[model samples]
Each structure stands twice: as C-alpha cells, then as structure tokens.
Target: MKPIFPAIRLRDKGNWLAGRDGIVMAFFIHRDHSEVGPAIWRSIQAYLRAIPPGSLNWYTSADGDMVPLDDEGWEHNRHVVIERIGGGSRTVELRESPSEAGSYQVEYYGRRLDSPFHDAPATTLSFTFPTEYLVEHGAVRLRSLALELARELPLNFGYASFALVSTQGSWASADWDITEALLARYAGLDAPRAMRLSSDLGTRALAPAWLTFLGQPLLGQLGGIDALRDALPFPEVSLLPMDGDRVLVTLDEWPDPIDTRTKPIPPQYRALAQRMEPFLFQYEGEALLPYQQDMNRWIRRFL
Candidate 1:
C-alpha cells in the first residue's frame, strides 16, 4: 500500500508569502511551561530518525554549544542542522525557540520530502511515512509516532498560516484546492459561493470561512463532530458571522440581516451551535486572546 500519511493543504496566505512556495505549520504549548521538556526533543530526534537512512542527514555546529547562523542569519535554537541536502536545490532551514512571553515557536524553510517524480502535487506527507517505505520493507516514518508523542506532550500541533513559503524546495507546494466538490468531501459542508452579495465582500468572507473549517487541524473537534454527524442530521461544520452578540449561522448571502439582541438562535441552527460549543468555548478562552487577535486580523486582511 502507498504510504498513508495525512497531507495538509494550504488555507490562506498574505500578499507577500502567498506567491512563494512552502509549507507552514505551528504548535501552541500550554502557557505555564517555561521551556520545552526532554520528551519533545526525544520525540523530534525520533521523528527525524525514522526517515530513510541515507536520505536523512543533519548538521551540528563546530562550537557544539551555541548555534551557528546560516546564509539567511537564522539561528537554530538547538544549534543542530536538522538536515542538509547535497544538491543545488533550495536550502531548508528550521528555527525554533521560546518567546519572551513563553510559547514555543518554529519556522521551517524548504523542508519537505519531495516526490522522486512529481511537482505541485495536491498532497505531501499527510502525516505518513515516505512512499518508499511501503515497497522496500525497511524502517519508515509512522503517523502513530507523532500522534503518540502529541498525546504525551503538552502542545497543539496543526497547519500553520503559510505565506509565500518555501515549502517545497523548488516547486512542490501543498495548497488547498477549495472547490465545492473538495469541500463536500473534506468538510462535509457545502462550499460558500459568490452569490447574493457583492463580489468583493463575498470573496473576502468565504476565504476566511474556509480556512477556519478546513485549514486548521481539529483532531478532537473533528472526533466530536464525526460522532454528531453520524448521530444527528447536521453538516459536519458551518460558518456564521458574529454580529455584536448575535451570530448568524446560515448564510445564503453576504451582509446577512443583523438581528436585535433580543433575538434567539433559530431552531435550525441550535444543533450546529451546540455541536460547535466545545470548540468555541475552548478557542474563545483568555489564554488565546493574542493569538485570536492576530488571526482575526489575518482573516480581515485576507477577506
């Protein structure tokens, strides 16, 4: 069988980075932790080790303690070169460190295993081992390794808001093709169309909506919705506009009619709202305020 990994597609990007080619991902750890623990490093090392032996290689600084800056002037927190490819291809770089506020940060450049013979493929490593592993019968990467480590570590891992990124060294970038057909299969919801509203506003609104629903990974949230979708007669996910305290759940148009504060959520939207309550509450808490603010700005800019 082909290597079964979960490949993430692009959701949105800023004007500058959208044009570039790359993969972006982020992990948000609990605020209380001052530094990453041993387990995270061990997990990282193990994940790196799982790659095909000769295909995977990394670098260590000469001083061996402090990191060495590369051509781009980025300093790897661990002072370790995760991997160094030999060819003239674009150099891949990874920078990781904790912020003054305390959350861990990471940015990778030109880091992805490209197809031995494909470019601009819709999917890359969807959390799976390389394709060679399936037929070669040797050591291979596994999704379970990452998933297990994730369960043990205290961090949130998922798609990063990619910009004009160097995800694929030369040309292979994984971007979401958000056609209604793809949306129906991936999100179990009808894709929003440029109907009923002025083209510009509708175009803006729909992009952010799709990112929230399909770009970010919602392992736990999806688990709950999967059960709900199986048990109840509701779509897996939906988007609404929050007007003051009022949230409009169904949108057949742009600039939906604003309701007065006295209005209650209609019966049809109640189930979808209830199903989405946990994720809403979890994301709306105080801890993520700054992140939420930045995300809101991105949406507004993209929309």
Candidate 2:
C-alpha cells in the first residue's frame, strides 16, 4: 500500500511546497509556432478534458506572475496562449499553482527559426500532474492520456515519467540541495529542464523514461522499430507503434522511481539508454546546476 514514488516537500521563503515525486508528460516539436500552433492548442484542450475540473485554477501572466483563473482571466489567458502560439510572442507558460501542495502545470517554448536569439531551438510542451491523480485514476488511464496527447501533436520526441516537479524559478535557488539529495537516492526520478531543452534539444533524443515517444528522423536513424527491438530485448519493455511513423516505448507496466540506496538502476532502463546513447542530446557549456560537474554525465546516468 506504499506510494510508487516518494512524496517530497520543501520550504521556500518560509512556505512549504511540493517539490518532487510527480508525473511529467512532455513533447518537443521541431516545427515553427505558426506551423504547429493550432495542434498544440488542441493537445492542451485534450489534456484539460482528461483531468478533473478546476484541477488548474491559475495561470502565469505576461509579466511572469500568477493570476487567478477567474472568468475574465480565463478569456484573456486563452487569447494570450493563442497569440503566443501563433508567433505573436516568443514563449508561452501556463501554470496552476506552484505554491500549492500538488499543482497541475503546463508550459510551451516556441521556436523562431529566423531569430538570432534562438539557437537550435525546438518548441517544447510540458504537462505536470501530481501522483495523487495517478493513484486515483490508475496507470492505464495515465498512459492512455499520454498516447492521446501524442497523437494530437506532431512531436519529434516526448516522454512521461516520475519527476521532481517544482516552480523552476524558486526551486533552482532554494531547493537544489534537497533535489540533489533525493536524486542520489532515486535513480529513476528525472529532473527535467524543459526551457533549457527547448533551446538546445534540437533533434536529438533524451534519456529514456517510463514511456518514451520517438518520431521521425531520429527513429529512422535508429533503423526503425525492428532494429530498436533487436537492440532492446527486454521482455518487460513494450514498443507500441503509432500513426505518423512514431513509436511509444513503454519500459514497464509502471513507472519506477527506484531507490538506488537499496537497489541498482533497472536493467530495462539501462538497456534503452545504451541503445539511445549515440542519438542522445548532449548538454554543452555550463552545468545546469552549480554542484553538478557535467550535465552530459547526468544525461548518461543510466549507462
């Protein structure tokens, strides 16, 4: 009857906040905002429909602030999101409540291929949900929802897994020590940097998660599904093909936040990482965190 992943809470500015052990479903698209705006909106709508009503009741504003999701705020947010997605703005972010115990959050970073500021940009959309929802609705429902969103968006790469979810701004400054501690103990928990990845991920694959979505050029480079299957011979891993030449690689029946203090990294995950190392994205330049020596080493943890 224990929880699948550890529940984490941390204090920031004298306020206790939920910091880790949540589910994150994210996708990266290589298309420009003008080309993929409508589809992203559709996928967002689908996510809203799948979750409970009022699960999201607040959103971040233009000034990088949180606004109540009132009647007027809702209408205005819709307009802003549409405008940003249509290339009216460079990035789009929406959140429920970062200070709340467990909040639902969504974020999108668009790409302007012609802009000097954007270097190898690939638009990214990330959706976060508390583990309580998964416990209530079951893993099948969560996987079905991920599949549904995948079909709606033309994603080059995507994943769903156990993650350390927090407000990026505060968590980085206040909770990183705690984060490093938790990560040391739990090898399966992913600490995602969606905004940074949006700018740098490009067409490369990331480390494999519980549910890894692979599409296009990268999938072709790997010699398609048959080759991938031959490389990853684990029986627990399931490869489900989807429309649009994409494949959803499910590592196991459920996401495991393996406590490495007591057990080693799961073999299935290591196998997938080994098969994907060549095509995986390498983090260059400065370390993402002050304490971390090399981001690439972190990306290759499964190896």
Candidate closest to the true structure, highest lDDT: 2
lDDT of 2 by residue, 34-145 (tens): 6777777778888889877887777666777777767876666566545643443345555666455445777777676654666677888888888888888878889999
Model 1 RMSD in Å is 17.1
- How many backbone collisions does model 2 have? 0
**Candidate 1 C-alpha lDDT tens digits along 129-164:** 222332344212222233333333333212212122
Query: Candidate 2 deviates by what RMSD?
Result: 2.6
Report every candidate's CA lDDT.
0.27, 0.77
**Residue 28 in candidate 2, Cα distance off native in Å:** 0.4
Best by TM-score: 2
lDDT of 2 at 79: 64
Where in model 2 is the C-alpha error above 4 Å?
Answer: 1-3, 16-18, 83-90, 98-102, 285-294
